[model samples]
Target: MGSPICPDCYDYLGHVVWQYHAPELWRRAIQDVSRQLAARLGVPVSKVSKVVSRQYGRTAEMQARGAVHFHALFRLDGPLDEGIGAACGVGVDVMVEAIEAAFSRAQVQAPPTFECDQSRVLRWGEQIDIRIVREGSRTDDPDAPITGEQVAAYLAKYSTKDTSLAVPDGAHVHRIKQTCAEVHEAAILRAESRRAGEEVPVPVDSEGRDHYVLIGKWAKELGYRGHYSSKSRCYSVTYRTLRRRRARFQQVTKSRCYSVTYRTLRRRRARFQQVMQEETERAQRAGKPVDLAAVEEALLSQEDESETSVVIGVWEFVGVGWTNQGEVEIATAAAARAREYAQLRAGKQ
Candidate 1:
């Protein structure tokens, strides 16, 4: 797909610059989409935003032609309790029109690479897919709608996907990597030259972001520098909030996917029995009576020796994951099985 007729006609510089500013382009597109909605609804831009809101999740993937592609799911929602929702008038047809028009008009300029001083025009590819997601089985129609669950699961899978394997090895891919490295080196020189009072074009954006200063770091990513997946801020709560509320109080059950199983209770009981026996034997040896309440408290308040150890070293934040290898393996296996089952169900649907 890398120019089936003439590969040399492809603009490698434009491709990389577009890849780098992909996020900004998407942001501008969303703004344009809002404006389009406002115009269509005959409402002011400022007031429309207050009534209609858009929440979306975007994931980037490597196309067969070594270019970048975005698969986004936009959800038109309203204020939580403000009662100013899409129920007022907006529908799926309006959303589709707005999004298509927005992307077609969305454009962001990219700074010139070190090798070339020519400005680059960054925008999405001509090919874009906008589909309506609903909850139902597929029909015999060629353009049948998809289920929300399917889109969610698909995007979620791609969000964490590694594109290295998905990208085909070719001269086009290698050239993109080379362009990233060259652009990065050029940016460093430009920054240094500007600091030395030289007449170098400024590479900073309006927000002072050195757009391609670290382009070389992502050379392995085929010149793409944006996040593989992202969601709107209002789309959901912070991960910190999720981690804080990971556990919820539920009735003790002997069976369930994420519930406390009977084996877990059996293990706790076994540990409690051992602790009670040890304390009783110690009390008997000292010719003292064993308090039942004290035994129960001891069992409940059980702590590791490390927990009571002196704090001599400073603590630092580390990346998140399972606490041990066993948990990691268990989680990995469960995730693999879940993915397989999900695929099977999707096929059936």
Candidate 2:
């Protein structure tokens, strides 16, 4: 986990200070950590096959203590074995130490501006929690086993939340409002300077370049900027691939159903027409009335020979319905109507 320090610098810079660039800062931080871990493990950067990372954010109190914090997950290739290491041949314990070192070394330099006095150093919080994931093994903590499914669900749930929905009672909210006002004033000044053909001074960092902080653009987010979730190229299968697979499945199913139904219907129709033609020719040759019952029986016998027998059943009437009162009433009415129709068909109505 990484968090920003709420320094006194914010009094001058407002919420658009170095901390506002949490997204970029942590991106660099994670990269640094990965590089350091790879070097320690003796793995060449080109040979590294998999490195997955994701980021999640939470709003801090609006007071001076308020700033966005990040939750991150990292996965490396292979098991926790020395053989998997590249150069130094270290294991998981050593990798964890390398991460700690990287966090300490990772820092974000501020673009020299009136709002900031100096570049800010970034690091993880003191409460660093690291755990080893193993299959079918529970942890000592009350949270118990840390399965991949649980972790994914946890990250996904928070990633979709609205950051702007945080309560508006904190000091951070006040600073954000103040920053909005300042940004508005700056825009007006820039406009006037441009109309007067005057060169408006812009703040630059130590690199001697103009800092790009479009304060108005991020005012609604309280100047905090970063993606809720991100992943490396080789992390997992992409959304595009899943969608394509689903589309193909649906297409195949539809084609199969249509082809089967058309083939069956065509075969039955051809057989029926052939049988009728044969019966007509026999009647004409005999010069007598057609034996309709025998012809029908012959066709049915041919069908039985060609395919499986069609099962038919006649059951005695039993009590209607199962449990529901409404269903019982409907079933009783249906049974009475069925008996009346049967009697009429038998000429006994």
Candidate 3:
């Protein structure tokens, strides 16, 4: 269930454009909130902790209109002395009011360099919603209201998906192009009637591909390719920092790294133990029982008493192929399948 819409008036292109700018608009709205809070607290704007944000949206097909609405999760922070966590948790109402104030004054400007007819400048849609997230809760039931973790997860989920509004290969483009061409043909027919002084209704190309003054300028957005990830000053960690940490981890765990070399040697030791186990199992199956339990116990005791050694700067593959642990697992599974197939064939014989 979502908002009401009329297809003729609910421009799909406009919805797409909004998606593209949604990220920027959200950031502005959140910043506006922080600013208001700082002003009320008599603290410098810089001292106001930043809020983190996550992206979320809804796509609904309605009565001839497609509505795309977005929601954002915002987290607030504070200075250490004031106990930031407690402040943000308890002052949600204050934050909400501040955010509402900011939204009232928030205006998103399109890129200045683009040439648009001032007559049809775009802006945010009519409806806006802001809800405060509560602790340890997933949702505020519409009848009972409980929004929190549910809100955060929701926003974070959409942080990476762009709507299929203008998919280069999507159905919408074919429809739009066909519609435009039909409108163009109709206009030409009406022009002929007009020359004869007939009051024929003329169809105007309100949304033509050549009309950069309108939706054409935003075509690349299909029309929504906005900021998918954002947060207020005090929300959570930055995307940049997360990316840096991942890069660092990758560097340390690089295939040629010393840790990988050590892991390789460990695998080799495991393989040797596995071979010994297999030989023991075969000996038992042959009915020439040679204290199999005692042999297993001895092997375990030896393993416990012996320390496996590994080189710090070299990586090795103990198995037939030079692959790491993960790859080895995959290879081992394939080998098992092959053995099963061979056994099945032998059974058929």
Candidate 4:
């Protein structure tokens, strides 16, 4: 079950606009972090590159209240040669302080809406958390610092998070979609007026304007118009680069990087599906019933390895979902169970 919505009126326009500009806000926030880091380390802003470089991996999550939260892993490294090792001089406490100051300094002047008739200042929320990622397993101490794998897992889990919210009476999830539609209608009228050369009074912010029309296009996402996950250019290998590498590169390279890579997880998923099919086929040939639990255990016990294989077969498109009503019912029941489990876990969080 989702969280209960409040009875009070919500500024739907402001909410959507803030969600629309979240990417820009994050960009400016990171810049502020760099400035803060420079000040903390007594280095000039322009010369900070010579001393250290800042890199981050971020994933955006939507709260049950329909607000965006970011889980980011920020690291400071030396200029070019010393690598992440040089960051030891700055320490985690300084990073935490820089993050706090950055959050305070980061603000975006949102576009004016019909309801408010003035530009709004959007800032990060008060609930801030900073964690130090240690190199190895955590100690038995209750306050032991978390490991890199723990941090990466936290980000990976939330990057695929379920989103649900409804404003007004807060009874149905469709209410948020309805709100997006209403906002879209107003924006359409405003655009029409501008095209006809009529004077449409829209407040102009000193920073500039944002396109509000995207709210309707992303209505299913409750007006969030930004990426679910992003990272700095130097943080890790990008998907485009990885795809290029997979095509022509015949060698394996080693480099210090994030513990989790989305591309690797995707490849593992395809491999898992292939293994399951093989196991089922083997069981069928022996005239034996398939044991799903045993198959899962076998997969988990095996090491993560893959080989180059020749795939010579005629493949066909499979239906997106169950092909029959009986199977549909079973799938629906399974989905309901999964949703309930997710709700339980969310409550624990």
TM-score of each: 0.64, 0.53, 0.45, 0.63
Output the worst ten-in-a-row residue range by lDDT, candidate 2.
79-88
Task: Give the Cα lDDT of each candidate.
Answer: 0.72, 0.54, 0.49, 0.71
Model 3 poorest 10 in a row by lDDT: 111-120
Q: How should the candidates be ordered by lDDT, best one leading?
A: 1, 4, 2, 3
Q: How far in Å is the alpha carbon of 42 misplaced in model 2?
A: 3.3
Rank the candidate models, highest TM-score first: 1, 4, 2, 3
**Candidate 2 on 112-152: residue-level lDDT in tens?**
33332444444556766666544664344666767656556
lDDT of 3 by residue, 83-118 (tens): 224234336666677767777787665432112212
Query: What lDDT score is found at residue 253 in candidate 4?
Result: 27
Better of 1 and 2 by lDDT: 1
lDDT of 4 by residue, 1-349 (tens): 2333553465666666777788889989999998998998898999887777788899988776676778999887666333333444567788789888999779988766564467789888888777788898645565778888778778878876665422322543366667778877777777777777777777433443325655689877777778989888767756765775564233222214524467766876786787789878986796545545455556555634442335889999986877899998998999999999999999999
lDDT of 1 at 22: 78
List runs of model 3 lying over 4 Å from the truth: 1-24, 44-68, 80-90, 108-126, 137-147, 160-162, 165-220, 232-234, 251-349
- How would you encode candidate 1's per-residue C-alpha lDDT over 227-275 as one tens digit per residue? 8888776566546545533521232232347566666678767877898
The deviation in Å at residue 195 for candidate 2 is 11
